[model samples]
Target: MKKLCLGLPKGSLQEATIDMMKKAGYTVIVNSRSYYPTIDDDEISVRLIRPQDMSRYIEKGIIDAGLTGADWVKEAESDVRVVVSLIYAKQQLTKVKWVLAVPETSAIHTVNDLQGKKIATELVNVTRRYLAERGIVADIEFSHGATEAKAPDLVDAIVELTETGNSLRANKLRIVETIMESSTLLIANHNAWEDEWKRTKIENLAMLFEGAIIAREKVGLKMNVPNGALDQVLKKLPALRKPTISSLSEGAGYAIETVLDETIARKITPELKRAGAEGIIEYPLNKVIL
Candidate 1:
C-alpha cells in the first residue's frame, strides 16, 4: 500500500495540532527549519502548510487529507469532504469567529453603515461575498497582515478572525457584527475518499483525533470503596458513561473507576473521600475511545 500524504497546518495552529496528534498515538517531530515533519506511522507522510492553503491543496489531490479552519475552506471554495469538525484554536478549545469590527470611537454602529467605507481583511473573498449578500458595497482591501490595526486610520472598518474578542478589545476595537463562526476541520480529498484503503485510513485517523479531543477535557478517577458503601460512592460520582466496578482481591472491597470532566474534580474529590472512598486517584488522560 502507498503511504498517505497528510498536510498539517503551520503557523498558529501548528503546536496545538502536533500536541493533539501525539495524544492520538502518533509521534510527530519537526525541526526548526523543516516543512516536513516526521511521524512514527510508516503508512503516513506529513507536510506542513498554511491553514489557508490546506483545502485547496487537498482539493487538488496534492495531499490525501489535512487539518484546517472551516473559514479558509469556505474562502478557497475547495470541494473536499469534511471528515469532522474539531472545535479548537491556538489558545482555546472553542469556535472561532470572523467578525466585522471598527474603531471604538467610529460612528459606524451597524453593518449597513459601511456603505462606501474601506474594509480590510485577510479573507477578501469571504468578506466580498458577505457584503454582496447584504446588498452592501464597500472597498474591501486584502490586508497582508495586522488586520486589526488597519481600522480607523488605515481603513474605516476591518473584518478579522478571532477566537476571543480580547485581541480586538486590546487594539481599541469593538465588533459591529459577527460574520461567521468556524471550527477546525479534518478534510479529505475527493479521489482519496473514493479509494477503499485510503478511506478506511482517514476514518481511523479521524476517530483518533476526536478521541484525543474528548480526552483533553476529561480525566480518569479511580478509588477503592468498602463493598457496603459502594452504592453511596456511585451515587456521588459523575461519569461519561457508567462507572467501571470490580471486586477487590480477597473480597476486601470494591474498586471503582470512571472518566469525568476535569473541571469538577476538585469539588467531587472531597465528597468521595468523605463517603468512604479510599486511595482515590485522579489522573490525566491522553485519549478515550468510546
Candidate 2:
C-alpha cells in the first residue's frame, strides 16, 4: 500500500482543481480552515498549497507533485519534471498573461520608458529578469496583493496577472508590455519521478486530468439512422476519429454513436434530425481519452 504525496493548488485554482479531480474519478473533500484535504483514493495524500509555492515544494521534494501556474515555476526557477501542461484557468480554458501596466495618463508608454522607475508585482523575480533582459533597470517591488490598484499614484507601474484586460481597464491602467503568458502545469519532484511506483501513479493522474479537460469541450452523441438515410446522417456527423456504426438487431438501420465538440452539438442536432436521425441522444462526458 504505497502512497503518493500530491499538492492541489489552493486559492483561485482550488475549486477548479477539485472539480477536475471529480471528473477524473476521484472525490476530494476539504474541511474548513484545513490545508490537508480528504481524497477518496487511499494511495494519495492531498495537501492544499498556494500555486505560487507549489513549484518550490516540489523542487524540495516536500510534495511529490502539484498543480501550479507555469509562471510561478519559471519565477522560482525550480527544478522539476513537467507531467503535463493544462490549458485552463479560473474562468476560461486559455493562457493568462502577466503584463506591465501604467495609468492611462502616465507618461510611460513602453518598457523602455520605465528606466529607473518602480514596478509593483507579486512576481518580483520574474519581472526583474524580464526587465534585465530588455536592458531596462526599473526597480521591482514585491506587492502583497491588489497589485492592479498600485499604478501612477502608488507605483510608477505594475506587473499584474490578467485573464482578460477588463480588470486593468477598470483600474484605469493600460497594458504596456506582456511580461509572460502562462497556463497550469502538473509537475513532479525529480526524486519522486525516478521511483517506478510513484512515476506510474503520477503518470496515471496526468492522463486522467488531461482526459477530463478534453472531455469538457466534447460530448457523446447517440442516434438511430434509417438504412436509406445512413449516408446523409453520417455526412452530418463529426467525431473524434470516425463514428461507431452497429446494425440494430430489430431494425432496417444502424445505431450510431460518436463524440464531437460541445459547441457544435446544438447546430448539428437539428441537421442530424433532418437527415433522418431519430431517438437522438446527447450526453455529457467525464473522460474521452484518446
Candidate 3:
C-alpha cells in the first residue's frame, strides 16, 4: 500500500499537536528550521504546513489528511470530510472564538454599530460573511498580523481570535460580539476517504488522537479496602463507567481500581481514606480507549 501523506500544522499549535501525537503512540520529530517532520510510522509521511493552508491543500488532494482549525476549513470553503473535531487551541484545551472587538471607550457597542466602520482581521472572508449575515456593510482590511493592535487608529474595530479574551482586555479592547467558535479538526480528502486502505488508517489515527485527548483530563486510581467498608468506599468514588473490583489474595481485602477526573482526585482521595480505603495510588494516563 502507498504511504499516507499527512500535513501537520506548523505554527503555535504545532508543539501541542506533536505532543498529543506522541502520547497517542506515534514518534514525531521536527527540526527547528525544517518543514518536513520524520515520523516513526512507516505507513505515514509528514509535512509541516500552516493551519490556514491545510484545508485547501487537502481538498485539492495534495495530501491525504491533515489537522487544521475549523475556521480555516470554512474560510477556504474546502470540500473535505472532518474525521474528528479536536477541541483544543495553542495553549488551551478549549474552544476559541473569533470576535468583533473595539476600543473600550469607543461608541461601537454592538455589531450594528459598525455599519460603515473599518475592520481589520486576518480572516477577511469569514469577517466579510459575518458582516453580510448581519446586513451590515463595512470595509474589511486584511491584517498581516497583530490584528488586535490595529483598532482605534488603524481601524474602527477588529475581528480577532481569542481563547481566553485576556489579550483583548490587556489591550484595552472589549469584544462587541463573537463571530464564530472554532476547534481543531482532523480532515480527509474526498479521494482518500473513499479508498478502503486509506480510510482505515485515517480512522485509526483519529481514534488514537481522541484517546490521547481523553487521557489528558483523566487519571487512574487504585486502592485496597476492607471487605466491610468496600461498599462505602465505592460509594464515594467516581468512575468513567463503574469501578473495577477484585478479591484480594486469601480474602484479605478488595482491590479496587477506576478511572476518574483528575480535578476531583484531591477531594476524593481523602474521602476514600476516611472510608477505610488503603494503599491508594493515583497515576497519570497516556490513553483511555473508552
Kindly list the per-residue Cα lDDT of model 2 for residues 1-290, writing each as its tens digit. 89999999999989988998899999999997899999999999999999999999999999999999999999999999999998888888789999999999999988899999999999999999999998999888999999988777789999999998999999999999999999999999999999999999999999999999999999999998889999998888888999999999887799999999998888899999998999999999998799
> The CA-based lDDT of model 1 is what?
0.94
Lowest summed lDDT across 10 adjacent residues in model 1 is found at: 145-154
Residue 229, model 3: lDDT of: 99
Model 3 deviation from the true structure expressed as Cα RMSD, one decimal place: 0.8
TM-score computed on alpha carbons, candidate 3 = 0.99
Clashing residue pairs, backbone N/CA/C < 3 A, model 3: none
Writing each residue's lDDT as its tens digit, candidate 1 over 136-215 gives 99999999998888878889999999987999999999999999999999999999999998899999999999999999
Off by over 4 Å in 3: none
Best by TM-score: 3
lDDT of each: 0.94, 0.93, 0.93
Checking candidate 1 for backbone clashes, the offending pairs are none
lDDT of 3 by residue, 3-36 (tens): 9999999998999999999989999999988999
Stretches > 4 Å off in candidate 2? none
Clashing pairs in 2: none
